[model samples]
Target: MATVGDQLLNPESGWQRIDDANKNIIYNGNWISATGDPNTYAGTAHYFTLSGATTNSIEFYFYGTKLRIIDMYWSNRVNNVTVELDGVISSYNPNNSTNKYRVIVFERLNLQYGFHKVKLTTTSTSNNFSLDAIDIDSNGEITAPPLSKFLISSEDKHYSITNEYKDNAIPAMTSNTSPNGIVDASSFYTTFYPWKAFDRIIDPNGWVTNINVLTGWLSYEFDSPKTISAYSVQAGTTPVGRSPKNWTFEGWNGVSWIVLDNKSNQSAFAGSEYRLYTFDNKVAYKKYRINVTANQGAGDFLAIGDLGMYELDKYISSVDTSEVSFIKHGMDKGMVIDLEDEFIERRSVVKENSPLGLGKVFKQKIDTVKTPIKKASIT
Candidate 1:
């Protein structure tokens, strides 16, 4: 039996360890383990403590005739391998989702007999609340699957020109993904599957698929950035009947919301009906979630037709804030930031090295695709 973290056994849970000593303080998601040394939840994205998955995520299952649910979308997600009741991959979703990503729900998702993998190709600058482990509910207890064998499989270098309107790379799958076109370039104006958008010829967003509701604030998660003068958003139609609102003129000020002068809270369409919406300037974000506060619909009926973001970052000023994150962890004993200008000129990236221990935790790889950053190799 795998022992869970002390923090997860909060006062709310039914099960608790009677003999284990509560020795560590769980603040900012880290503290000393029974081992005594400070332990950070610095395992893989979405994955919890390196020892196991319970602390950081939920598990759903039962043997023979059992069901399971997997909670998801933390950071730098590589893959989602839904196992069949017999243990083969029934479906998959990979290195996707936006930065403010929360959870990805899989339903009636039957699984089979074997372990699975969620290999990530990209990484995020931070991690979020993973999970307390999977929840299982069955008349008879089901055995958990074996530890999944996973590895970061490299892919062939694929090349492709930028899209007609954007500079996004629609590279073909080397090994990690499938379909050069499906995963590559797309738009209502262009391509289609494995190499396409979530909803292509399938009538824009998969209104016929899983989603069923939309609430609270509305959001749109894009794969790339965009450049524009102004954006226009519309909800339901002229009257708020069975949909959201058809009001436009809402705006964003680089960071958060910039309340515009236009105000049209049309609840006529807020009663109960499906609606389609669009934007004129096409404002963008990686993920767009509209928090529903009422029973507008039993569940989320968001008929998402697209995903996009601002064309350009335009936030390049000076004094990268990331330099601040490094300051908190403690830097090289004699290293000084005053000479940062002479060290890296064009582009520099640092990766974690000692993923398990505290000794040294970084290595780096840089590419001068655009700017030329200088680098140094310590003797």
Candidate 2:
């Protein structure tokens, strides 16, 4: 009895065994049995040999998301084999000086779920073709997500203005004097380093100083829904008094904000560095916000230099084009008319034209024209 190592067939440790004698496998033409010692051939019972027949082939009908072909490789007698997976032919040549058995001849991963077929044909009569077994993953394959392109930052910076931050103190000298007190959060959106105290480098040149309010918030809206799992925040220049000490991360669920992750009594770091937070589960959302409830030193304002979010995957959905209008030039007004006289002239038939013959003639005329034409153009 053959056993699987991890029961999971992945790119790293490919497993799930199908021996040559499996019921789902079919061998055509004459094949010779070449059984080896258990110690020499990875505890495999038997192997089939093919030679001197171009029609000789082996077919496998399998239910798996991925398939891998295993065979023996030897320089002296091993021959080239034609591998076909789901009707696609892939040629493989095995030539090596050392006799290595149980080699992966070919593999296809991330295929559509359901049953698929694989065929291997012997192409050389002089060389020997050995059939070992096939590796398949019945658990199905995982599709990797597309790469993300959005970046979070303040306004006027590269790929900025796409994110929004609010309810924070505007850094001094960088605020616009609106009807309300100087907007303290302006410096948070600038393209400056050390935007917050927790930044890797403690630079006080630019920061978003919160108002005398204890609880502040920063929020960002992405252009599209993204699967995010981690985020980071740079504290303000004054780590003790203004840096956020306790905060909660929330994501918009189309109706209300839901807490994704939260941390309580988070101590302030001494220097400027981003404090990273990761969620155990991923959330797909377009909006994310961080609510800071307390600061390190009982300060009136809570300052943050920069905020960042990392996306885990992209949302995959199908688009419906049935309602879309696709207009082809010269295809709207073409009319097909069946002229009994024209059909008689073309086929030289004198019988009275029936409605079916007229309809056939009309279809023929339309097919011949290929493009729409004005009714006046028809003779």
Candidate 3:
């Protein structure tokens, strides 16, 4: 008899709460935090409030089987709330004639047990919206996985980028570029150097290209070869039009840059908005970069608040057993076996039997040789 709103009625076990002000949640647009009645809201403190706006949204990622959004239902509140769970869209209206607190605005149950991303947006243009808290099922303890180490972090010496803007004429406020190629862009605007994109801070004054720079490139060099399967890009504080609209994700494979993922005509980003893109990639490389070919009609410049590249856990999909062979003893006939698994990469020449004839044999390079070799009898 589990209830959605107000866990007091039928408290469900293993369901933990995530407050509105949690650092893991990303709030876009003008979201204000205000104090609310302890009895009315789930928590005793503050809740997020938004008034009279559309295109405003909030995103949260959780690892659980069920999710509950604790909001409010009132006359002035938002009439339409659009929920996007792992890219699937749904909508609900929380507008009611009477005030109702601790209401369950949206909930998804029995979801595939894994990590999920949910985005709640205000679809109604001219109404208010409130987010009290969020609840998710837990196994041992309710703990969201911490942000993984990025292959393009500013703290690590192993990670690096191209270069930063260096022009005395422009007079930068502070240059955070590194000589070891930590951060750099094709072009930058004064204080808005390229390093800010990898700084992990979502601010308006992030990495910005020069005005009228329609195309730009940002590259990263790793200390060792890294296999990246996913990446994320966050928009700056304002002017979403400055975001890159079309781009190609490339990796350097000792010779030339190979395109890992290509995107075209992407949707415009919201202020401080974040987006994650994943692709199929197995090869590891020491260098990776992004080549931006177009921007979202930002004839002035392009901007990026943050950039993160991630290497996911690798798993063996299939095993190759064709190269493996088994030799049985006590047989009437002797077989000449040159197992590739045992004799490869030795860097030495090995003399093995050949099917050409008894007088003829072939030589191959292998690391180890079978001791006490005997002549094979060919019938």
Worst lDDT 10-window in candidate 1: 157-166
Off by over 4 Å in 1: 1-61, 64-66, 80-84, 99-104, 109-132, 138-379
> What TM-score should be assigned to candidate 2?
0.37
lDDT by residue (268-371, candidate 1, tens digit) is 22212222222234344322233223322334333322222223221111111132223222222212122122122222233532232223334344454775
The regions of model 2 sitting more than 4 angstroms off are 1-14, 39-42, 45-51, 138-379
lDDT value, residue 220 of candidate 1: 37
Q: Give the Cα error of residue 378 in candidate 3, in Å.
A: 45
Per-residue accuracy of model 2 over 260-319 as CA lDDT, tens digit each: 998876544434445556564345787677787776664455666666667533221222
**Can you tell me which runs of candidate 3 are displaced by over 4 Å?**
1-93, 96-181, 315-379
Q: Estimate each model's TM-score.
A: 0.19, 0.37, 0.42
Show pairs that collide, candidate 3: 161-181, 161-182, 163-184, 346-366, 346-367
Estimate candidate 1's alpha-carbon lDDT, on a 0 to 1 scale: 0.27
Q: Residue 127 of candidate 2: its Cα lDDT? A: 65
lDDT of 2: 0.50
Query: How many angstroms is residue 115 displaced in model 3 relative to the true structure, after the best TM-score fit?
Result: 9.0
